[model samples]
Target: MKGIPMRINVLQHTPNEGPGMIQDWSDKNGYEMFIYHPYQFGYLPTADETDMLVILGGPMSPNDDLPWIKQERELIQELLNQDKPIFGVCYGAQQIVKTMGYQVTKSPAKEVGFAPVYRRDVKFLNIPEELNVLHWHEEMFEVPEQAQLLFSSDKVENQGFILNHRVVGLQFHLEPKEDNVREIVVNDFPYIKGSVLNQTSEEILQTKISDDNKQTLYKLLDYIIEK
Candidate 1:
């Protein structure tokens, strides 16, 4: 008999910020994906029913005291308690850090558009020393205790981290394709400012989406799930 497929529960905040390349990854891996819009439906899956939980990016800050946000944090905490695998992006990353008793504050600068993240003493995970990836967040998470710092950019000290070798949080977006980048730029251009680290809307749209970024994202997902 064929084995049952793993279920990936996605917590989506807004319509514009979908799973991007993660959906493709799930399909390729034969994992069943169930996207939940807690803002609209006010419902979330329990840790028992979810094989993997994906927390996608959004414009809202994880510091918001909204009911749905609180509930989502609770769900994330339960997942952590059960040692379930989780992958978090942008605001989702902040949520994970916040759930782990850390502060989510405004970043030094709004890291918009494509930027290079340097590897920061990360072992066991095979990633390039430097990689250009999409970043469109104004708030960032403080690295939690006992978490391995993965990558860091010039503007953001905590670009990524891994906890218990199963939960991953990324401040930069490695799962965005060209179209996905376009949608983010269009929706989040207002946050982009004129700074050394920030990019203009035109520049953000003009930058090429590298396949290496997607491959890196896939590698991370595989690593977390197989752990």
Candidate 2:
């Protein structure tokens, strides 16, 4: 391990979506965190200076023809070049998949509320057999050949993956606080269009997130940082 007080840089695509447990964990662990909103501003920190990279969820797809999207991928490539640990959530995970030359497309069955992701195999990650996590995306990606599949959901087979053992990507949100959920529900109301795999906004509100997801998130953070 490098040491205490790691420099973690977060790439936020929107003001509505902020790093929830990520920021909380970083603060508790005393890791210096810096957030960059490419949508609100235009600048990327050098990869070398950052010990880890965190990509937060957003409304836009990774394949969108936006300048910031391209720039985000470029920075991700540079971070990969530096062999830095990276944690991506939802759209952030899609960005990592796309940067790895994989394709992300509209899901046949999208998840708009809480869903269960079952563990495929006991490899590096110490995840549960099945864990319910927050879901709010209609797009999913193919697992890259170089990545190890970690979890699989009914709607999306590729629920979680790890690249180079240090980089982790999750299609679901383990880091969501209750307020985060409320904010997303309010902002992404359009996505909750009541698909077969999706739940109604009221249904989502009635559901309570399990504690195991947040606990596992802490374990995963430790795993990446320790590696």
Taken over the whole model, the C-alpha lDDT of each candidate is 0.88, 0.85
* TM-score of each prediction: 0.96, 0.93
Q: How many backbone clashes does candidate 1 have?
A: 0
Best by lDDT: 1
lDDT of 2 by residue, 29-129 (tens): 98899999887788877777789999988889998899988888988998888788899998999999999899999987878888788988755566678
Native-to-model Cα distance after best TM-score fit, residue 142 in candidate 2, in Å = 1.4
Across 24-55, the per-residue lDDT of candidate 1 in tens digits comes to 99999899999999989999998899999999
Output the worst ten-in-a-row residue range by lDDT, candidate 1: 190-199
